[model samples]
Target: MNALMLLVQKLSCDVEEHVFSEVSLAIEKPESYFEKFKERLDERGIDSPIDQLAWISLVDALLDHDLAFELDWKESGLYICDVVDELLDRKKMAYISWGDFEDEEFDELPTSQCLNEISGKLKEVGISLAYLDIDSDSYVLITVPSSDIDDIKKMAQEAGYSIQDSF
Candidate 1:
């Protein structure tokens, strides 16, 4: 069983994008992570609809918040699966999805089908969908050159998806 599966069992729900972001943020900046995440949610105007219970559950899973905060993720064994270099020969990447944008959800189609469509569109625009991980239903992670970010964003927008920087 992978870490994701363990987390899913712990949370008792499907792991969503926000869950991953919050966990990543918490691991990266334990002391101020929650505050920063709340600020970010406010900036995106998503704070209002936040599920407080879910947030609490996530925090509870941290186990002894104060003590946990003092430890580094690597020391604490918080495994973050990073496959960018393995899949795309890149050190940096971003996650793309139909993230709450007022666009048609790709839920009707299988993830592979949607990815194929997105890949075809990207290829048509001379962009390579080189690195991709669609393991989660809510998003796809891909490696994009910094120079090509704008181009990829535009292409994703045209394809009814939104792009977000990976945490």
Candidate 2:
């Protein structure tokens, strides 16, 4: 199994939210969607960092699920509201996981225990573990406050986990 890590800032919008808001718009206007969306988000008082890969993954996932409205970008905009409503109804956050470990290696990976430990440690510092993506290879993608990133890294390191700066 391949062990990889990514240091990502948690966005205010989850997968569903991002898909409805940004992805939908981007699909309709592929040329300058991000710039426009960023401007809109700024106006709305949201300052979360946007990850292009995450958005691409969301679009792909939507397409794979046959949730994409239509091939014509112009008509695609019509489904934005519907897609947002449907995804909101599902109430699921989007996350990606990696790793292909054997049953025996499951316990050796960063299991719930390790995550709970990290969560507790972070909580003490006033940082909540909002979301997590972990795989059998001990690769972890954690979402926490950007301000607490360094602290979280230190704690993870002290707990015997190596932090990779990127994927």
Scored against the true structure, residue 108 in model 1 reaches a CA lDDT of 47
Q: What does the lDDT come to for candidate 1?
A: 0.36
For candidate 1, write residues 1-167 as lDDT tens digits.
33432342322233345455565455455545656556544543444334332333243333222101111212111011122222232322234332322234443444444445555444443434432112223333443444565654554345333444322
lDDT of 2 at 38: 59
> How far does residue 140 in candidate 1 sit from its true spot (Å)?
3.9
What's the TM for model 1?
0.25
Number of the predicted model whose TM-score against the real structure is largest: 1
lDDT of 1 at 25: 50
The TM-score values for the models, in the order shown, are 0.25, 0.24
